[model samples]
Target: MSALSQLDRGVAPIETGMLPRPFVVRSRREELADCVTLELAALDGEPLAFEAGQFTMLYVHGIGEVAISISGDTAKPDSLIQTVRAVGAVSQAICGLAEGARVGVRGPLGNSWPVERAVGKHLMIVAGGLGLAPVRPIIYWALANRDRLKSVDIVYGTRAPDQILFARQLLGLSAADGVRVGITVDLADQDWSGQVGVVTDLIPSMLRDPDETVAMVCGPEIMMRFSGQALVGAGVPAEETFLSMERNMKCGIGWCGHCQLGPHLICRDGPVFAYPAVRDLMSVWEL
Candidate 1:
């Protein structure tokens, strides 16, 4: 059983800076080299209510806390889901933890994808590299709420076919009702036979009602920039498109300016925003 299963439910999420809450790893999945998807169950009374695209600050005792996106199925909020890529000390430590390990979790922080707004609109989800982690919940939402949208299309790109996230599931989702998935890779070996090139290369073939399409993109800045341009070129409005921004966030709340970009604090105002809102700022390298 998870350590969280034995702990008591604490307090309401009425404030920030509260000591981290106890949570235990219920399960985990290895998606690629250096990446692990942790399914956590909070040892408490009720699970934190979270929307698609939000993130949490996860604390691995003695190491540190890092802002990781909530990567679980939205319908299963009681189960905390986060995907960690071991690119740093803290993430490496998180990746080393096994099932049933205990950790501190302190959020459902940051803003979320505008799923409600995109409900009646056609949808285009673009993800690159580890970017797919943040976009997973939205895909889940789209799948469950397929009737609310005109269409749902996903374009994913990774270092290689081997680096793709949710490889097994993508195969199933490709055949799911009202959803279309297209994948591309930077390079491939003889054993691989999928599309080769950046994700944007597949955008043209995936275009569907760009004028009415609301795109949500989470990826490297360069990839997002080009994807946005391509979508806009295809008639998707800048204001109707969205992107998730990554910054050096210390505190999960707005009190910390570490995640500031122009007049917006990424923690509070967004990790996700309309393309027009931050299009100019995103042009400024590493802001």
Candidate 2:
């Protein structure tokens, strides 16, 4: 009934240069807790060029499609990286897949975070729980071009200490000059000596120029709502704060009605939106 299904049945395999080729998984690793990192090699041995913050729709045969943000750099186009959390049936299938398995992929889709606009401005990134995956690319980009940006700060929060993703990598970034990093956990373990509180509390201590800084936040809707308020209260402008939204994105393209929120579709217009753009929509329930 779906367009993809119809195409699969009726369309002949044509060598269209524009169509994306199915890539095979070269390796997969279990990262942090309950997360899988997949490294895919293109079937044709060509690299996929994509901007930071763009996502791809990965399709599993006889299963379903899931939108995964591309975690690797565009400069290294030979391989692609996707970090996914095992949270659903489809995701479980992806997590269960082994090396050399074939998976269909389409995209480099959606608008990326405005990295160009972020240049020359102090950047503040706040990520919570699995929200870290979507923002990971931006962090990598900032570090890769450290001299271009003025200052960088990252604040990541998870349910508990064990739930934190990219622990060693974040710690390394924190030690780098001109980059400040902080981690918070809702509940602390015996060994956890760092900050023990909500992520909002850490915002006040980070040195930032409210007028010249841009804050990007990705997390649960409730978390982002409160975080946005906290940033605004700290003198960061409303327009300077951006939030990445999550909804049931049944279709990666705009045709499906599953991800509609107000005048936009999470699959099309967002997944990332400036805070003011979706403020009203976030206020409504089941939107």
Best by the lDDT measure: 1
Worst 10-residue lDDT window, candidate 1: 1-10
Cand. 1 TM to true fold: 0.92
Off by over 4 Å in 2: 1-20
- Give the Cα lDDT of each candidate: 0.87, 0.81
* Per-residue error (Å), model 2, residue 16: 12
Q: After superposition, how far is residue 48 of candidate 2 from its true place, in Å?
A: 1.6
Q: Give the per-residue lDDT of model 1 (tens digit) for 1-287.
A: 22233233433344334468889988988878889999888888479789899998899999998999998788988888899999998999998889989988888888889898788889899999999989999999999989999999999999987888888877678555779999888999888888999988999889888888899999988999899888888899888999999887887787658889999999989999898888888788767
lDDT by residue (tens digit), candidate 2, 1-287: 64556556765332211134589999998886678989998898878888777788888888887888887766777888888888897888888779999887777777778776678988899989888888888887888878988899998888998888877777777554668999999999999999999889898787388878788898888889888888878888888888888777765667677888898888779877888899888889877
**Residue pairs with clashing backbones, model 1:** 4-43
Return the TM-score for each candidate structure: 0.92, 0.91
lDDT of 1: 0.87
